[model samples]
Target: MGKSERNITNWKQYNQALVNRGSVTFWLDEAAVNAWHCTKHHGGRGRGFQFSDTAIETALMLKGIFKLSLRATEGFINSLFQLMKIPLIAPDYSCISKRAKRRCCLNKRNLFRFP
Candidate 1:
């Protein structure tokens, strides 16, 4: 076993696996993001004052752009947003609740549009 790709038969220590992956930098370009922005979900409430493009954009970015965990995803989104010049980083587990593999946040869905 001189070959670098060979898998160790026993767990001695320093086990490594080589993964061939496409770089994120290639995909995070403006063209890709702009396309995603146009297709992202637009939840309906018959708007008088609805959620900003930023909130939805952040949500989409977490779920699609960065492909982060819902907890981490929501955390990232919350961190970037501001309410009346205040940082809106709410680390609420219930913010991305999962009862049966389906996320549900009844309160936050209607929580002043993440303003």
Candidate 2:
């Protein structure tokens, strides 16, 4: 009503207040870095070598963001993410979802067979 920046005098502090990621050390472990590197390079083939650091972060962001549904979140990541800013190693939603589904610890498929 009064000024365009009214009530938001300390925007920097306010923005910083929302940045509660716990810690970066645990998230960026050596194993994670190695995995990123391997994924980026396509297991040393150098096919996806152009991948950047942001790509991995973006992918992870998507997993957490769309925790309930793999389809929606991955679609968003693929379409909205800036390819140039992220690494080429980043895979589409389908790829991630398929891997997740396969790895899921679901009930044994044949355990309940009635035959």
Candidate 3:
């Protein structure tokens, strides 16, 4: 039995391919941008939420997808925003954690469903 080996003939294309593998393309639609901030007031005693549910869900989704810690997730999102030149701010790690717990409760009650 013999094993076949492959060799790179063009270093330019190979290097380009490697660079492209690390590139990530992301964009936020206008509707998503509009829904990023909380508009409705809960009329609570303390301060109201700045970011909407959509934002929190987005952060949590990214966290799970990237397998990143809460703080790392926050930085990742903020960096994405910076790259996109968007003025939006990422939700704090603590806020994401709290919302994640709440979302778990809602899921247990079958109140939240993902499509």
* Best by the TM-score measure: 3
- The sequence of per-residue lDDT tens digits that candidate 2 reaches over residues 1-115 is 5666658779889787667544322233344435554343445453453334444344545566445255665565544435334442345556554444433322234211221
Return the clash pairs for model 2, or none.
51-87, 51-88, 52-87
lDDT of 3 by residue, 19-98 (tens): 99887676878887889999988687888888888888888777776778999999999998898888998999999889
Instruction: Sort the predicted structures by lDDT, highest score first.
Output: 3, 2, 1
Quote the lDDT for 22 in model 1.
43
* Per-prediction TM-score: 0.28, 0.32, 0.68
- Alpha carbon lDDT at 91, candidate 2: 56
Q: Provide the global lDDT of candidate 3 against the true structure.
A: 0.82
Which should have the higher lDDT, number 1 or number 3? 3
> Clash pairs of candidate 3?
none
Name the best candidate (by lDDT). Answer: 3
Residue-pair clash count for candidate 3: 0
**Candidate-wise lDDT, in order:** 0.41, 0.46, 0.82
Worst 10 residues of 2 by lDDT: 106-115
lDDT score for residue 13 of model 3: 100
